[model samples]
Target: MSAATNRGGAAIGRISDLNPVEAGAVLYLRLWSDGAPGRAEMARDFAIALGADGGRSALAILDQIFGLCALHGRRPLIRHGSGCVCLGADENCFAQMIAAAAEGEHDDALMMALLIVRPDLAPALVALSEQFGLMLRRMAGRCAAPAVVH
Candidate 1:
């Protein structure tokens, strides 16, 4: 079965769908947006991994994405609470779309953009989403250190 498929041979449709990189992105975004108690620590870790400037820029892009979603009444269905780590289908979709957009898939980029913004603004959102996706990828790569056996 492909990484995108589940045990039942159906397409994975939720953030619980764990491909390591996408899982990391989903966790980061969830903590970043859901008022979780871990938010500050995760942000600090992200900053450490990407440096202050890159972290700030990446976070700004996230803010813009969320802002546009709200502005356009298409807010992503994120299911997180103060300490919950559960994943949502919408969050998975966003992570996948952002990753594809960052990979220069123009159709995915445009479709993702159109999900939250007007056509005139889709181009700009696509660029921002691409940047955000790249940052997420970098964070996942840098932070996935091998575990030490005791």
Candidate 2:
């Protein structure tokens, strides 16, 4: 099932289909896994969510989304000081991020959480991607896997 549907019922809607903040968080995490999402990407995502008339609220929401994910134990997703984050990392980094998140510095805790959860999420995301591939095949579309990640 899609991540959204896994939470409950089918996801019925558009990009706005998700809870704004939660959607932002998932997007940020996914993008971060690929590469650091720069200002342009952030601007585009926010613009789409907030509208042609966007403002600091979008920025603030993005920050909070990452922050909350960190708080909830996903900090290991970010590489320390490298500014390049990942969906996974070494055990030490994972441990530290968890500790930081537990202590309340959620914003700084995302990297570790990512590392810690990688073993679990990796398989699930992979399975989902495989399912997507099957769907694409049935539709006679090319399945472009996202860069053979990790």
Candidate 3:
């Protein structure tokens, strides 16, 4: 689902440009896990949804991940900070995420990004992402996964 679908709306391409620390954190956390084969798309969608709060920089990073995976068939590196993880997407720079860690929890990657970029948004973003992911899964008729997370 698109981020637009997750919430009611957003500012369209008005996200903040990432500072180096924020960029590094976003990329590292996203690429920190072993994502499912089709996960990057979810990562992108989730990021877009979260972008409603996080802005364009988040969208930029997630879009990059989506482009890398959806187009290049490359897995996003979700553990590159430790081993180059990109959430089943490409390894390009600039990234984003927030909210979702199995119910009432913050997704680690999203948490990391929020901490680096917008710490105030961490809590809300996680809750929204989790709720949105659950809603999307149900609407799509898939079994609910553990989280709206990567």
lDDT of each: 0.66, 0.38, 0.37
Winner on lDDT between 2 and 3 is 2
Error of 3 at 103 (Å): 3.7
lDDT of candidate model 3 versus the reference: 0.37
Candidate whose TM-score is highest = 1
In model 2, the worst 10-residue window by lDDT is 80-89
TM-score of each: 0.70, 0.28, 0.26
Q: Name the regions of candidate 1 deviating beyond 4 angstroms.
A: 1-16, 36-39, 75-86, 145-150
Q: How many clashing pairs per prediction, in order? A: 0, 14, 32
- RMSD to the true structure for each prediction, in A, is 7.3, 17.1, 16.4
Answer with 2 or 3, whichever has the higher TM-score: 2
lDDT of 3 by residue, 1-150 (tens): 454242212222211344333333343344423355324644554455444444334434444434433344322222233332222222221233322332334556464334323455545444444443333333233322456756
Q: Write the per-residue lDDT of candidate 1 for residues 31-148, one digit (tens) a residue.
A: 7665555567666866897898887777778778767766763443444443444555555566666777768896876876675567777777778778887887787777678889
Local accuracy of candidate 2 as per-residue lDDT tens digits, 20-128: 2323333444454444555557566545544544434545544543444355433333322223222222323333343344344454554334443444443332332
TM-score of 3: 0.26
